[model samples]
Each structure stands twice: as C-alpha cells, then as structure tokens.
Target: MPDVLQQRAGVSVLVCDVAGPPVATTETALDLIGNASFGGAEVVALPAGRLDPSFFTLGTRFAGEVMQKFVNYRLRLVVVGDISAHLAASGALRALVAESNRHDHVWFVPDLAALDARLAASR
Candidate 1:
C-alpha cells in the first residue's frame, strides 16, 4: 500500500509501487519502507510498469538523491520487474545496473521471482 523502509528477515527492504513522484526525502522513503515491510520480506520490489518517467531520468544526478534515502537508512533496495525495456533505450541504464549490482545494498533484478532467489541466496 505504501513504500517501506525497515528491517525484514535481518535485512531492510524498501517496498514501493512505481507510482507517484519518486520519493524525494529520506523520511518519505523510510516511511514507505516501514509501511510495506511484512512477513519478513527482506527485499523490496518496485514494479517497473508503474514507474513515473517524469521522476526517473536515465543519466540524471537523481540517483544520488534517490539512493541516499535507502543507503542512509541502511536498507537494501531491489527494483524488480522487466527492466529490459528501460535498459534497451540507454547505455546509461545498463551501466547504472552494473554499478548498482557491484554494491551490497542495491540491486536491479529482472523480476520478483529472481529477487526472491537473490534474497534467499543472501541468507
């Protein structure tokens, strides 16, 4: 129902629907993470189909601001869905994925099932 930012299964997940303007503040992001954390879900899933284009720019500095919320909260964030369409349009997106995956806190998964696999593996 809302974005979440809290501990789940020993890891913090930030569940969010790709609706509304991308959360602009750490407070809002954490609020979302807190709201959606349930059943010990350690990974958050942001559905791709609902992402607001106006807020997500391929090469923009938005990454830092957006990422800061999760990183600051010490949470792991997974944006899960068919991201190929988005990746296909920009090399920057592909690079972003690569770079994000290199980190311990952020992930770009192809789908929720894959995310589940990742979550399981992390344990």
Candidate 2:
C-alpha cells in the first residue's frame, strides 16, 4: 500500500511502493499516476530502481512524456534515489534536475530524507 502524509499544513505527498518489475515505459508511468489520482494524492514518490535507464537519458522521450503527464494531471513527482552517475553523464539532464528542484512540481533527490525536506519546504 502507498503511504500518504501531510508534510506541511496542507501539503499531501503520496509515497508509492512499486512492487515487482521496474518502471520502464509510459504505461508504467501511467499506472503510477492513475494510482496516485485514485488515492487523492498530491505528490507521488517513485523510488530509484523503479525507473528504467532510459528515463535518465535526455535523448529519450520517456522522461519527457512521464513528466508531462504528471504536470498535466497537476501532480507533483518526487524521484527519490541516487542519480549521480546519470547526472555526471549528461549536462542536460543535470540542468533539468536542478531546474525541476527549484519548483514544487517535480524533483529528483538523492534520498527519501531529502525528498521529505523538499516537500516540507514547498509548503
């Protein structure tokens, strides 16, 4: 089951526990999104290993599509885990992560603790 909590006064974040295989495509992204929506969650947290390698690559449209969907649905997405290698590999992706972190919509953090702090700060 997913955990939903109010981080701040009224900021609710949904921590998703993805079971079984990894999230490799748009379909998987949608599944998570749908679940979040159904549960009335404002933010969704996807662990590091749940995502595929392509999501870390800027050239691939997987990340874009997934991000767009989250935005379109008015859902905040927090990708929790270490992405040092991916950031080191591409400057574009690094920039994207930095920019996303500046807002309350989407964020990429090194760990769940960082994500918790981020959500708290947003409110």
Candidate 3:
C-alpha cells in the first residue's frame, strides 16, 4: 500500500510501497507524497516489503531533490525494514547507507521500531 497521509497533528507522511528498481517517472514519486498529504501523515515510512537494492539505487537518485524536499519541508522519512538481506548482497547499497547517514535529513534505521523512535526524537 503506497500512499500518503496528512496527520491530524498537521504532519504529512508518505507511506511507500515501492520496491524493485525505481520507476522511471517523477510523477509516481510525487503521487506518493501527494496522497500521504491527503491522508494525514507527517512522515513517510518505507514499509518492510519495499526495502530492496533497486529502491536504494533508484530512490537515491532523488536523494537531494525530491527526497530532500520531503525532509526539508519538515516531513520525516524512514527507510529500514528488513534490509539485512539488502545490505548483504549489495556493496553499493552499503555505501549508500553510509553516505546517507552523513546527513540528518534522512535516516536509515533498522526497522519500524527504530524509525518510530527517530521520528519521535525529531519531534
């Protein structure tokens, strides 16, 4: 279920169901953010099923653009679910995680619990 929601607390989060290689459409990414705003979510969390190598490579393309917009606009993003397998097979991904960590706008946590904690701390 890839969707976006605007929380009652005035926060918007886009829940992503994107897996596999990143799609070649910017509109698709924008849709996720729009829908989340429509819902009532303040932060976008990558569900457990959507964590894949492609998501990293493809998703990271927008790291400084669209993804950064989400964070800069005060939206939180969580991208860790069952990434152990993702981390094991891809050195590029490992590096991506390490690089992504150098910044505070994005978070590469271990799971939803950690994601929640990070988001809470952000608040």
- Among the numbered candidates, top lDDT falls to 2
Which tens-of-lDDT digit does each residue in 1-123 have in candidate 2? 544544433566667565535779888788878878887888888886788999999798888999998999999888988889888999999999999988877899887777777766766
Question: What's the TM-score of every candidate structure?
Answer: 0.67, 0.87, 0.60
Evaluated at residue 33, the lDDT of candidate 2 is 82
User: Model 3: per-residue lDDT, tens digit, 1-123?
Assistant: 434343423335555655533433455446555665566666677664543334655445643455665665565556756677767877876887787766666667776566656655656
Candidate lDDT scores, in order, read 0.63, 0.80, 0.58
Rank by lDDT (best first): 2, 1, 3
lDDT of 1 by residue, 3-121 (tens): 55555445555556566445545455566556545434455566655444532465555555656666765556677777776677878778878998877777888875677667767
Judged by TM-score relative to the true structure, which candidate is superior, 1 or 2?
A: 2
Which pairs clash (backbone N, Cα, C closer than 3 Å) in model 1?
3-32, 3-33, 4-32, 4-33, 4-34, 5-33, 5-34
Answer with 2 or 3, whichever has the higher TM-score. 2
Candidate 1 to native Cα RMSD, angstroms:
4.2
Ranking by TM-score: 2, 1, 3
Q: Which regions in candidate 2 have their CA more than 4 angstroms from the true location?
A: 1-10, 18-20
